[model samples]
Target: MVSLAAALASLAVGKASAEDWAGADAETGQIADIAGLVRLAARFPDSGSVALRLLNAQLAAGEMTAALQKIVVLYSRGYRLSAASEERLLDMADADQAAWLGSLFGRERQSIEASTVFATIPANALLVESLAQDPQSGALYATSVVSHDLFVSVGGGEWRALGLRDAAALTGIVRDPRNGMIWVSSGDPGLGSEPLPGFRGLIGYNPAKGAIVRRIAAPEGSNPSDLAIAPDGTLYVSDGLAGVIYRAAPGAESLEVAVPVGTFRSPQGLAVVRGGKRLYVCDYRYGLAWVDVPSGKVNRLSGPGLQYLDGIDGLWLHGDALIAVQNGNRPMRIVRLVLSSDGKSIESARVLEQANPAWTEPLGGTLVGDQLLYIGNGQWNRFGEGGAPDPDNPPGPTQIRALPLGK
Candidate 1:
């Protein structure tokens, strides 16, 4: 909120141009005085863009309180918020119910050309006699960052439940190759309508404790669908809802942003293409798309069998192409896509397997080691199946199943 005096002063400036807001690099060097922006907006009155810029400025400065306040102001003024913006604002407020407001409301750096390799899982957990298991024997599994003990399940059998360090939504969990510490993302575990103010990122999990004892800040509003690790240890996580990709490395303070920058929309399943720095961003509905780490641009792969590859939730680099898990109850199928050397073209894609009619659901998945794929098979109607899920807590049950990708 700006003072009457400052508001009156901005009235003199009249209008602000594109030059008014700094680039991602120099923006922090610019002042994050929300009051000043508000003043300028007061003068222009038609400064919806200015208000949004101010909001982003405040966010970069860690002034979430001011940032969110401005969102409310913008909304009351009929400022149409994008999904990404609305989600972040709601995530900051820790509002779950606010998610229903999606229709209304609602980084980067470096030049690393990415490559990808694929993995396989023939079957997700086929619920036989009411039990589930992991695909990879040594795979690490945690329900979310906000649970009991961080559970690391080895072998394709029932998992012993463990809790998380804090109450952060579990985005993507991957075993860090360097130290084997499972890196996880935690933020306002995006669950309810009213969000919790002061909510931010937190991480944990150590070798000895088998849980995250220390936490850190992660990028906001990511229900990370898939986790990818570069040979260089560059960490990548995909936000299913925001269509944004978050990059991080070991011992980094904050995460970095990637291309198509949520400016595009709806990327659920993501993976690194083998032999290159190109990351494939599979849309919630579209087929496999590639993100050039250097240019920060995205190119969608489509044609013939590649067409209508909807509800892709998981991606992996396999051999000369990429394999994806189609997320749907009826339209369920595990498909494989071959990429061209140019990286811009898709040669062919095929459905490797389909879910059994009896057990009709699948979500995100991962291929374990050399032979198996672990599918996070979800339950009917509820989240986690057969659990004492508190209304305040999510009961989204998704069991890990072992599928043979090789055979």
Candidate 2:
């Protein structure tokens, strides 16, 4: 577990953009002043990082009552305090407060038991981002961030690289259910060794031929991150750097903006729902939102039980619910958010996995039958300047976990 101060500092230097406010406040730098953090906590009430920072500030200022109030609110939202945080609160509390704190800590849920490993990738496949599985043949394909290549594993056998031509730091990949063609999102995040001069868009690969058949370029200045395919063959891609969502029609040659800029701060994951009428997008800094495909109207998903939807990286629709991989949250978790009838609000949320012993950082996944197979140990932090792997501290073998979604 990361210390409170270190977490606060990490949130302070996050990406600066209109939609990048998931953890930090509005200002670009650290919010050391109590008044600023108070406003920040109010703005993002569900953010555990902001609440912890404000609590630390209050304790440092000798405002015990305010600190206790924040703790109560956090507790109500199912946020657990770290061991160090609990000790600090206990030291400042009176007898009644101390007793309440003890009870709160006692009720903390134990870590979910580790899931079964479905497959393991060798160390060469650096920073695997997203995954796709062929429903008919059980062939698994993974996208790499550092290597800018696609890897394939057949029948749970050894992983081998399938070279992509002129690709730049592959992010998202999905199999088009209509025609069985594999689609992957390609973008230059300034991390790859070989920079492709004038290409940042989607690549359509035919797995049977082992070749890329079609290529569609995104608009200028776009870093497409995640891909979602609707039932009707329309493709949706999220641009994390430009704060836009692009859509390409069934046979269109180029991509068009579905949700324009200034809408989301940094969109990461996308899920199409309601027979392709609605699209759910996960903004890394903001929470979850759904867009009306025809009218382009966006609505923020809200409910009494939908508290920590801000930090999700990968999202998939399973029946009426949404399974999210939330690597951005503290003590990163995999959550299941049950939706309402109309898909406008989240009815309830359940933590499927948290504090797992196998996680370096869970990134993206795809639904395979009754299980969600995802990248269990995405070593994104192992990369240094210019997205190069550190020779001295090389990443270990990557594990992909199979998390069962029980009926």
Candidate 3:
């Protein structure tokens, strides 16, 4: 008797061949070979042309159970079938299969409101992470995670690509409102390529000229993740791997360690508080911490029942509240945390958006006017082992959604 583990293992690595379906008709044989078909489907979930044929075979043999399960898993893995493939699936699906699919992907079927969705323009790159609104022109700019390009869009306009030179892994962006120069954090060399003497800090870009004006390098062997600009134009960057925060002036030639190592675990997002006297930093998994600018003393901020602060990627300060895009949480959500009078601790927090339909690896966002414009669907999971988006299962259009501020 085959054990369940062995059966699953066999299915995982098994290969299906033409001889396996020789006896049965093309239709019946495909569905009859359930285990083999599933194995093929699993290996090629992104291949719409492949998955659609398998689904048809399963339908031909009345194998709805296996087909249903495969469909759900493929969708979860970021598979969007072609129009013809989708029509076939819908036409062949039974009431039960249709109901299950509807319940699972109902949110995606509906159109997101234009007001809430700032833009639905397609970008040249995928896996977009950080967003910054041009306060002067009302244009929104975004940086790609896996691609080395920046995108800008006017109010409901098309997204124009601005290529970056020698910079990969662009993570965060913030426009210096004082001078309109954009500050972007990038690990241009990419992971494992570090230790090669290269720039590993911020890229100062002139939006008007659409060119990089300056490249500020961080300490040797550092990967900067998120960035925050102080009221006085001081830049605060979190080095997730180095476990330190680096500080630099806008036009400074070099970066100096601001918060020494071991201050926080995997620090990501940062927000400089009012008066520029202190800074709030999210340690990714260690909740939130504040550092006194005068002393550089880092202290954790706790609230009632403060247990975990895992998965906080984008942190923004609005008035006295801290808006956090907590994608690490199961189902993911956007939270509004009100700080105490002293700005020392979180008094309370409320869910602004929870179990949201638009969330797909929510990353960074910025406050624009009265709305919080964020990357709604990053589609980071669409990348295959080769680090490129799978052509067979192409992602849908990227969306920049706006959530009302103070909500």
Candidate 4:
């Protein structure tokens, strides 16, 4: 009799799950034929074996491109890439195949100027630790902090890395429609010696020019992790240290909506749904909850799955369902959890995308229109040697990629 753990381990490494099976067949929106199964197998490849079955097919068909695509595809659909697995892939890959896989690594001197993935587009941002979308233009604003960039591509323009002034790595990004400015809560400077801990919080850039517009710090010493701008332009900031949420109306600096946010312990993400009718906060420490913008009423929306995780890092409202991001241990992961039909609690969770130790750090995500933009930070990588950069650690692939929204 195989032990239960053994059985479960075997299952994970053997064949693709029904959920992954269904995702690979996006055309029919259902899993049916062997071709779809083959794709799923190649992409996800069960739990234990690294889906060697799929890799063999890739090698046989000479679909090296397709094979690489499949690995990334599997990840977009919530598959975490482990370090051991990367080592295995590298070891076995032939010359051409090895080159393909090796190409994904980042360089210290050379930066990924641009990257585009035609894989399935998920309505949820996979690893997006923080997301900012425009309610009016339907345009999206996402920051790939690990990559040190801010991007906008609604009307079509390759994902532009809106460079920041003082070596900025944005966490929370949003648009100022009124002023036509894109702002992000900036981190410390990267170029100088011992850069300040958290330089001016609000860092804005000009979309048209890709230049830094200005940098503004929270008036009363507020260090924010995520930010949401209201309909009237009143910005709501989730203060990571204080475990509190504050509002800054337009030009004013003093915090306005200083209501006591319950147990914001380790809480970071926030999204405004229905044009500021309410604000959703991922208390992370507690779970996902929201504050009624008008009445200031707070409620806990945590249920069985999604928000209950320890690294319940970020949250976003995708139409009816409230999407969540869980960056637990090791194989950092991403998920597009669905709310129960009642619009109250989490019912079912589907792994939209995942980040393992090698490719990138799984932080959190932002849910865009059928698009999930995830953020990664190697600064705190758990599996390998992770920590803040030394004098010149040669920025570890500070780049972000947009996964195709699954059909």
TM-score of each: 0.57, 0.84, 0.68, 0.54
lDDT of 1 by residue, 1-407 (tens): 34323433433321122111111112322434777666644433333445666888787787865665555555543234545655666676534434433433421111211112122222121111111123333554643333423344554345554555344445455555555555554443344555433324435466556555555565555444356767666667666555567777666667667753433345655666554377776655323466777776655554332223445666777776677666531235666666666656556666565643423355544555533344344433333332224455433444445555542
Rank list by TM-score: 2, 3, 1, 4
Ten-residue stretch with the least lDDT total in model 3:
15-24
Highest lDDT model number: 2
Clashes of each: 50, 1, 0, 30
Candidate rank order under lDDT: 2, 3, 4, 1
List, residue by residue over 246-326, the lDDT tens digit for candidate 3: 999756988889987655556789999868899988766445677888987766665433223446889999988988887
Error (Å) of candidate 1 at residue 305 is: 4.2
Assess candidate 1 and give its TM-score to the true structure.
0.57
Candidate 1 ranges beyond 4 A from true positions: 1-140, 144-149, 155-158, 188-190, 196-204, 220-225, 260-262, 274-276, 305-307, 383-399
Model 2 — which ten-residue stretch has the worst lDDT?
Answer: 12-21
Per-model RMSD to reference: 16.5, 6.7, 14.9, 15.0
Each prediction's Cα lDDT score? 0.49, 0.79, 0.68, 0.51
